[model samples]
Target: MNSFSKLRFRQSIFAKFTFSFIIVGLIPLLALSYISLNTFSNYLERYAVTNFEQMLLFASKNVDDLYTRYNNESKLMYSYGTNKGQILGETIAAQTLEGDYRLTRTVDDFLQTVLYTDRHLQSVFFVFPNGAYQTVTKQNRTFDFRYQFPDREWGEVLQQNRNLLSYFPTHLDNYYLGSNQQVLTFGRNLLNVVNAPGVEGEIVGSLYMDVSMGAFDEIFQQMMLNSKDVVYVLDQNNRILYSSDRASIGQTYVQKDSNEYYRMQKDNANVAWKIVGELYKDELVMRTRKIINTIAIVVGLCIVSLILVAIWFSRRFSKPIRSITREMAKVESGNFDTQVTVQTADELGLLSRGFNKMVVRLQSYIEEVYVAQIKQKHAELNALKNQIRPHYLYNTLEVIRMSAVANDDNEVGDMILSLSHQLKYVLDYGQETVALQEEKTNIEQYFRLMELRYGEHKLSMDFRFEGDVLSCSLPKLSIQPIVENAIYHGIMPKSGKGTIRITAEELADNLLCVTVDDDGVGMTEETLHQVRQKLESSYSLDSGGSSIGLKNVHDRIVTLYGPDYGLEINSTKHIGTSVRMVIPLGEVNASAERHNS
Candidate 1:
């Protein structure tokens, strides 16, 4: 039964290979062909839509520019009152008997001479609030002089209506050689008398543009021939005012009084005007079908040719490829012992040889990494020992000091307790800095112990803490070594009791200030200056007695805080000595400091 199962499994390989090959090959071919078709279609569709939006903006800008030009001209005309910026300033004595025709004639003379010759302009008109009007046609034709006021001339449209700007029904059948023309009429209300007071103010003119749809249609036709796109022109309300396809013009592009995005406008509302462009969906669909057909033909022929070559090479390629794949599988599974055994003299053989060498190198690297990890663990263990053992010693000493207290040796016990407290403060904060208050306390405790040991050694302590200064932190051993320097060099060498006064205060502008003053056997001017200069500058603490005397405090401050915060010294010979420090002030929150760092 076992041998029968082995025979059946061997047959299953051929069946699996046929099924897997069909699936892998066909799925990619079909999906890739579809993607190619859709990609081209989408690109063209988006390209046309983008072009349409740009065209919309361009047309809107043109209208705005034209309106601004006309408005500026009226401003120049209004300035005629005092000839502030006018070419010809005139004052009329009478309002009515001065004659409406006279003012119309004056404006007409300028329009005919300056405006009628311009190419883009179609017409210019002057409208009086009395409903009398005059116009000059820019078109290349002649007509009756009285026909210049086309009855629907802007003044007559607002004869009884007081709208600032209005669009009214008008006949163009008798004008323009009896041809029907759709016109977009824009108007501005002008005063009849420049700077007139109250009801005396009259409509001067309605400067308007009656845009012929034929001009835009011509431009649209040219565009449609060159690029398969549609463009729509919109008014301030985003209503479709014009379209490349004449049929879509005058239709509502977006619904009115609708809140839904799809039901509302897609573009901005404050815009003076807009142009919207898009390609036809049928054009995109047609292109997609062409793309799919082209891909289908190309892929079918490619597969037919590749399959013929694949059949011939399949048996020949399988042996080496299968061997390489198996070797890579071992590498993936982290079995570096498996070596590729192919003996070809081509690039494939070179790759196999390189891979084998890489596996050997990887094995060596793994072994070295294991050894390094063991060494790292050993170093970490030693560092932890260094950090914890000092604290244990301090705790033991504290226990001894308490025991002495129980034995009723008050003087001995108190001295022991001071030393023990100082030791614990130092050891418990071995790798950390302590507050300025704690540093002073530790220094005082050390002083008590020293004084206890030497009965004749008398010293007076004068320490004062000002507001917000005592809370500032300093290195744990900062004050201790300085105190030791005084005891050894200055205080001890002196003949009588010495005074050690330490003061901590905050400067008015938020700075930490520490001063340690000692009236012991102070050095001469030259020596004191040298000490100050040396402590201010940087040098190694492992240098000399100078280093032990001052560099310890300097290095600790600079290393923990920064260079700006190192020790500063000032002194006068035999008068006294002071060591000062200014460090960045912060309450030590252990976790926050570590996280920020």
Candidate 2:
């Protein structure tokens, strides 16, 4: 029964392969050729659509550029009047026919400069509030409005439209052109820079600019590179203002044909202009059909030959490929010991060798590179543990301090407590810096411990912090070392009671100045010079055996802030020693770790 079932399964596999080979070898060629042709046709349609849309966008931009320039020309005149406090000197409302010709001459010169500088400007006119008007034209510097339109009707129209940039519907041909051609008029209410009677930003007059339709002809010519393409400029009402087809001008463009077409339109309601472009889809399809047919024929032949080769290749290729596939699956499952056996010296055999080599290399990489990195990380953790070894001492001291407190040896308890607190603050390798207040608290605790160790009368201390000095930040244990040096070296060696004063004060240029001063047996000039040389040199100092001293403190400050922030010591033989530290007045939530060597 098992043998019969196996025989039937083999037969089913052969049947499936035969059906698949037939479909893949022959049917796909015809089906794909048909599909490719349809796909090509669809692509051609999209290409046409995209091209027309881009053309319309270009046309819109060109027209917009022209309109923007025209608007800016008139707006420049308005802007000048508003900015300069006058057209030339006199106000727009102040300028009149009855006024001196100087005002008119200045205004004419200004407008003439406008016409000369901007080639797109055809004319500029200012209609005063008193029904009087002045004009500057590009026709010539000598010619004025009267030379072009020798009538009061134009002036009256301009005067009536005082508050708006009116767009005139009439053609410029009657007034300025010898033939009938459409023109657009853009006008705006002119404003004064400094209003009379103290009313600033007041409307004073009207300004008008004319844009000829001839400018758009160049744009249309550029867009109509293909004979089948159509372009139109429409008003807000969809009435054609300009078209590539002369007959289509003033007529509505209706898309009614069954043939494929691409359409694009850009509309600006503020200017009431719409640029529309259309391309015939038949043109694109006709252009691509020959190429499509050629490719289809070549692809069909290639597919037929490839299918025949594929059948023979599949029979021979299946075994090694299956073996490689299984090995690769094992590799994907993280079994890097899996290896492919090279069966032949062909490309597949070379691939199998490469695959086996990759697995071996992967296993070696895991053992070498990854394991080394993990061990390096462990070493770093160990180093961190070594750096924080002081924490162990701190914990032991904490236990001793608690025991002293329990045994009612209150002074010993206090001393142990302060020592523990100081240890905890100093040995904390977690942060790189601390606030001035925290450092001050730690210093006070240290001072208390010192006073408890040495009688307070024998060594007294004073702290004075001025003007927000506590908000600033510095390296941890920065101030405490200076205070320790002052107490031990400066004050402890004195005969009578000595005073140690620590002051933190705000200084000029965003600097916080911390001074540790003591009235003790001051150092001799030679000793002071040696101390200064020690501070200036790369020598390290030790305080109370374990604590870092002046040089380390100075170098840490300089490292954390800058060179300008380190210690400066000044002393005289019989006078007290003063060590000043200057650092920038900014706060950061950081603490000192291991200092950079």
Candidate 3:
């Protein structure tokens, strides 16, 4: 062991700092630099190839979704458009414009419905051979067709391109917002023939649908997190489809490949679609170098001081009993203000300060450990109480008092009734949870009774809930007490109408949130700050609400669902107050409903 220790030679401050700076600074920069250049280049190559494959896959799915939506919407547009044409034809056949305005209102209504379905769609217009046109869609803010407007774009395209399906690349349009047309436009040829429908010379018109490129742009935005990374859409010839920066659109780039990134990418033809990402490895090494340099500079001076100390230490050790006694005497009287001002930066000076810090840390650690143990004991005791003793007795007593209600035993019944209500709440226990819908119902009944006792001057309750949210289970009586507090204390004290709106939303996480809000007198900053401090300090129900009632709800939520699911309160002056509970999608015991009042 001695030999091994000596193998690592005694390091001076200069040497130690050199090593430390290299370790902390130089290593990271170099590592990151290598990653950014070589490793990332290689990764990008592989990514490009893989993404090329993915692009095809994504395209297939995207095509299907787009086609289905477009086809459905287009068909509706065409059917209504064709019906208008037929009605117009029939009107002309019967010579009915002076008398043929029968289908005019129908045509107008159909066009309006088509226009209203999607806002982004520019227009759905019909063209005729005589260069006259009939457009039925709301093109912009303007309503109806541009009559006798020359059909140039659609007209020329129909003559040349015979394919029923055609796609146009990104191009600007001539109208208002449409002029800066960032769209993928689809044009299908519409035909009109005598008796049998024919898309011939009488190519009556076409269906025009423009889809915004915002979604594609959004996809690029999502992928490009770092400035070094870029997402590009390309045509078959590697011409750019679009870049986030408009200037880069239609431009091309030669990808730089490094490491296995290139090797992996070259073979995988679909790499373009995979979106391989890159990292700068050399930065870590470079950073390490910088740190080593700084440490060397600082430690070089420390080493010189250490050498001076070592020389002094050898000369001074024997004459130290009196000095040690004096230092100890200063320390004993609670004096950290005194310094151990010996002529050396060696053993005794280090030992003195080191011992002081050790004492501080030891005392702190002991206190922390003691507090933690107490908390654990309390939590275990609470858990034991949480699981034991159902609230069935309270439910039974309520039924007993109800029977007394039938027998007209008012005196004893009233006493039992009061106790039963209190017991039922206690017996339900803070650890228990009930269905959200059930709790709402219970709270509604409780609030209604409270209102009856207090009168309408207290507050207005805006209890609006969707039936869909009713099935969600929550801790029992969670909402009632919060509302009761607002009425008895917050709103009832104020003159104006205080509104409480209890709302629920099914969150994407599959958890449910119930928010109870009131527009009462609200609270001062002092109270809110107190609440925040209390929550941070300890896990107790004693922070917000009317103290006891809110404490009960908070305790019940936490016990039933763990720490993550609990109460949050927010309030504004004269505006309102809100209490929200986030409950997990978990099962409740069958006895919850049976034991309810």
Best by lDDT: 2
**Model 2 per-residue lDDT tens digits across residues 368-422:** 7777756755665565455446656777888998898899898998998888878
Backbone Cα, N, C clashes tallied per candidate: 6, 9, 69
RMSD of 2: 23.9
Candidate 1 regions exceeding 4 Å error are 1-105, 113-118, 128-133, 144-153, 156-181, 192-195, 198-200, 214-231, 234-240, 247-279, 292-297, 312-597
Give the worst 10-residue stretch by lDDT in candidate 3: 260-269
TM-score of each: 0.38, 0.39, 0.32
- The local distance difference test score of each candidate is 0.60, 0.69, 0.54
Instruction: Output the TM-score of candidate 1.
Output: 0.38
Tell me the tens digit of each residue's lDDT in model 1 across 205-265: 4555454566466445544422344566676555666666566666666432322111111
User: Candidate 3 on 85-122: residue-level lDDT in tens?
Assistant: 55333323332325545544544554456556765555
lDDT score at residue 279, model 1, on the 0-100 scale: 47
**lDDT of candidate model 1 versus the reference:** 0.60
Error of 1 at 479 (Å): 72
**Stretches of candidate 3 above 4 Å error?**
1-64, 81-111, 135-153, 160-163, 175-184, 192-202, 225-242, 248-597
